[model samples]
Target chain A: MIVIGSESRGSVPNTSPNVRDMAQVSCCQLDEEEFRKCCLQLLQRSEELRDGWSWQQPQGSEDGYLKKTTLRCVSVTSKRSKKNQQDSALLIDSDCRQNQSAHVSAAPEEATDDADDEDVADDADVPACSACESSFLQFEYHVVFSCSYSSPVLYFRAFTLEGRSLTLEEVWSSIHPNFRLHLQENPLNAVSQQEHPLLGQPFFLLHPCRTEEFMKPLLQMAQQHHRSVNYVLSWLSIIGPVVGLHVPLQYFSTVCVKDPASSSNPG
Target chain B: MIMNNDKDVLRDVWFGRIPSCFTLNSDEVTEREAEPYYLMLPRVSYLTLVTDKVKKHFLKAMRTDEVEEMWFEYEGTPLKWHYPIGVLFDLHASASALPWSIIVHFKSFPDRDLLHCPTNSVIEAHFMSSIKEADVLKHKSQVVNDMQKKDHKQLWMGLQNDKFDQFWAMNRKLMEYSTEEGGFRYIPFRIYQTTGDKPFIQKLFRPVSPQGNPHTLCDLLKEMYPAALTNDGEQKRYQVLIHGIEPLLETPLQWLSEHLSHPDNFLHICIVPVPTD
Candidate 1:
């Protein structure tokens, strides 16, 4: 009933599971930089379809066959900063995303200078149609890369793949059947279009609050466990499809890699 | 302790024995394909559990920093920590079923993380089964000294007799020895064995329902063996007992789940016919 792992401060500990860090301690402990490097590796691997975070989408056939066009969690990133700005640059990235719909270069527009000092909420919340200048921003689940956290989050915006981004209707239709209800209720997945801290665009963010809970154990494993893991690939493998991004596994083996150094007895 | 290692008889299918049941696609992905985000859980969630070593490996494999509880759940119920994958598979005819699905919770991501793995996971199950097999082999043999054996017996008897107070009174002694492990805490695992089948070792922690209904062993049996209630019935009835003592028929499963949360506690199924007029 007490459910140990209280992280008791190493004194005359009340319970064995109650170490000072066990409850809060992560099994893996890579820092931000190290995590970034790991994610970077996976980002590249996912691009080449070398990592296992993606798979080929099968076609309808009498004779089974897999198409070369694979269904994978593509690691998407915006250029670093508004030339080192912040979420405001991400704002242009979102616009660039809209421009993508018109076959225009999605490069962050230079017009988006630091004039963002005004009430960002004045017109920022609504994504305007680049050509129309009146239509609101249509955010799609573009899926983003975070340099600081070195993790991939469910970033959404308008003008996704196939030129234009998924319309709200398309997004609603494409959402995983199981995740739809929770997507509505999960405060974490709630649609909060804002400027990305690094990309500076009005992208819909897959809330990171609840995400922290899941990452805690993973980080600890990176720190405590002996085997090296591709934290980004794992994160995408675990979180990508929430909005329907399917990443295939690269190493298609069924072996649990054991640390030759750490295995004796776990009693 | 009448262990039935179905692993031998039902091994090949798991090792790629083409079933006479259906033809397969050589190029296309099967029901169990390589998926990154989701894990495929077995239809029987309560059936199997991963070993700690593999649990660590699985966490590492995810390549995420999400905090994962060292436990896996099926429909929100955590599997007992001690269940070896083979034992769980045997209970569920897994060899024939081959490759049951696995469930991994994204612990920190409460809302979106809790998911039913879309594709059945091979690496997780393989890791679990292999680690368990290895652990079993490593011990080769165990000597629980006569004194400890007697102590264990008393504990078993207390369970058989349904003496909750007496059983726990002595359980502490066993736990004290393992406390130096990280801190003195209750061990994980609550196993249920039944006379219905000879040592069909299965573990599932059935938490109480919110409306206040304790899921009991009887409920589990009904769920596990649905055909037991025949439509052609002629006054056929059944009784459920734990250890040897009949538990209160309506005893909430939550009660059992809580009382037997420890790794050592076991509920062996011992069924017998009660006399009737």
Candidate 2:
């Protein structure tokens, strides 16, 4: 089941090896709606608690074993990028104002998840020599979408204040230090350059499968404890870094998520 | 599959070897009670094949008048009669060119003193002395002619001292031979470990590479888990213990072979998460 390398010997042409491994797990028997329902149910409670991440239910027929849930972490844009965004933003103010409705649904945590998609459709229309002066470009939309197979695959793209798509290479270079560990070794998973299956756009797929072995115990702990103490926050703290999604560690002080299993013991 | 060669069981660690059953207090038994007859068995015994129906051919070969039922012990655990002899060595000892120094205990002598066998310390001493004796064979057959005075003194001194630490540090070099001696001159040794509770077997390389670069037990962890190299992941490094003592990551594998690597039990790979403090 070699997936990413030159020798991709997976039996299904579209199915990757990671997805196949996920399919082989005992949890694969769970249907798409139930799968999405279970994961979102956990995060939905966390969201009500204002946990580090926000969840979105799948929109259409793209679910497999579960209605793939989406997790997003919003980060503020760098000051320099903000300045550049503002300069270019005024030039395209008309377009930026047109998509204010879509921007409202972005990062609920930041209360400031900025950016109006001024030019979401066209990459070629913008001139090369000019600077991007989009005024509202202050948010980084980091999202990971789950698959029907219960595998969490990434779907991410960043935009400027004027709504210009940031190059996948830019996102690669700007990966958080906590997430840099994966990028430094066999970095192909760092920013896997692939076309978004749904958006029909080029985007980086931060592979979460690398941590498959690392997360098994966490999942087992969740099940063995009957219910996690704070399963959603614990899950995001462990997984958010793998895909370059920045969920601040400060929110999870003692990391009591692993407590679910340890809590089972009376001793 | 049944294999006659003990080396095959010794080195093929991917599947892991079944452990030896011999249980006892110490590795070497210095004193022994005289049995009816002292029978020196073959250096290596691997009789898994069955004859006609119920009789085992290999065990039958080692039979004597008083040898009602032959068995061996380590520490104090009794070796199982059902398993083959080759696998017994594989379970207890590292793969080596040197023949095993084991004693055959007959069941007939119930109340008498048992036959003594080589312990880890005794095995280590025998190998050290054997190499010294062989050194005399080189440079010329005239004993001690090829062996220099300094080399001769160090060998006997290390042997008599019974200081496993320093003796093995010096002798592992003798165990290795370059291409000049011929291809494949090193002893094949392996250790087993489990990551957390997930048990898996993996091969540990000799401390020195063919080019002579020093390697460590840490190297074994690195080759197995590439993620261990990172700052955040470095904490995932395995903690190896031969008995209960944790061997230092910097210590050479050859030293472990002499002092800690036991034939009776597999080495444990201890997994403990890095303390945040």
Candidate 3:
């Protein structure tokens, strides 16, 4: 089942060869040097990404070793607006029913948000909307280069506003329903808590074993089109949305202006 | 004879054990003094997977309310259960005396230094992920990707149950390579050092040189960690240990990876300061 799902996911980029008129080149895989260069380009091109993400070279590591890019305290607001509040409420309601003790404390505000809406409506002049009762989650994401896969793996951890870490269930609930379905379809490559390679802290990471498998076709299309794509930007644009790290469309537009020097360089 | 030697090395690496004593922390409110538990820990196994008996023994002395998730500490450092038992020992307490003394804590779990191991499933997931990562380095993940889910389970269950024959039966496939390629595409290894705050050093390293010369342990150290090696006539400052023994620097990386790797299939080398005595 997973194999079929991954194959279909891999083919999505192949079908859409002409994503944009912009000349964006992508690499099949990145070496350490290319990863560093791409990270610089990502930060330079995108201001929002730059504010959150910083290159962290672990102390005591020798020069030329792989450095990680980290983005801390990124706020992802999952709004349960009036239109979709019923669906979301049902989801949370079922969750509470199944695991009453475990999830009640973690999502008390969310569980009671609907009930409190009446009181909030009576007290406030403005119309009470579910958006006002939206739950906010903060995520810390690290982009570390995997030498084995020759790709950047995303390691992240989500926390509540009160500083408690979210369990895997809570994290899944926070993901956008669309991306959640796709992630659920391919559970093997889905987010899992693992020890951080550099920090030794438990952080959730998307397994990179299949990254090269899915990325090859996407990169090849860009290469064949004679477009110069930033590997990190292209990869992140596809993956980041699944975990709420949306790469602004402006990043692509800015990077689309081809640099003459990089264009001439061979893959 | 060469094959026999290889088998013997693999057996020796698999059977390596560390004798340990687990004593409850002094501050815990116990009904009575907790008896120190002694056990021979399997070098390749994870601490969380094999220490249920130790947890049970210590829990008997303490009230249920007083107890929390159990954690282990050696000296001042909290032992990370995710690391192989041997790597933890060699990295932190290699020079310590026999019957490695470990403090068992029932309270104040160090969330910063340790990952919570609530169940064996966590260990299994971590163990499988590691093998998958290692395979990506070895054969571009071809061997592991082609494996049936049942085959993967056999490897994990073997390690969990301490069955050498069951593990090697499936693992031998992951270690194979074409004669033309000579060795694994890249040797999966992590060089650990005690002095650094860094977790470990991992990078792409080929088991064979471009000229078809096999890379030895010395060649790897020279490229990745030159500080671990000593110059001729210079005093040796560090010992390069695999499976708690210093194999000759001339030992081929391919052979060591094949025979000396833990169940997770990575060559875990600890570069510790040599004992002055």
Candidate 3 structure quality by residue, lDDT tens digits, B15-38:
999999999889999999888999
> Candidate 1 residues A1-267, lDDT tens each?
223333444453443221323223234333444544543454344444432221211222111101111121222323343322432111121112222122122322212445543423433433343443222332233333332222445565443322233323334434555666776773324434333333323344555434545776776676587645665556656776665445555522311242223221111
CA error at residue B271 for candidate 3, angstroms = 0.6
Alpha-carbon local distance difference test for all models = 0.35, 0.35, 0.72
- How good is chain A of candidate 1, measured by TM-score? 0.45
Residue-by-residue lDDT tens digits, candidate 2, A1-267: 111112334343332111222112242222234434444544443344443334432343232211121222223233443423442221121122212113232422233234423333222232222234433332333343332213445455554533344444445544555556656674423554443433323445655434344556766776888753343334455665544344445445544432233211111
Q: Between prediction 1 and prediction 3, which has the larger lDDT?
A: 3
Q: Arrange candidates by lDDT, descending.
A: 3, 2, 1
Off by over 4 Å in 2: A1-34, A46-149, A223-233, A242-267, B1-277
B72-151, model 2: which lDDT tens digit per residue?
A: 55333343322223334444433322244333444432211121121333233333333432321111112223336565
Q: Show the lowest summed lDDT stretch of 10 residues, model 1 chain B.
A: B135-144
**Candidate 3 residue lDDT tens string, A125-218:** 3222343333333456678877777888888776543445666665676566776787777556787777777776777878776677778988
- Report lDDT (Cα) of residue A242, candidate 1: 64
Cα deviation in Å at residue B80, candidate 3? 1.1
Clashes of each: 73, 27, 3
TM-score of each: 0.27, 0.29, 0.81
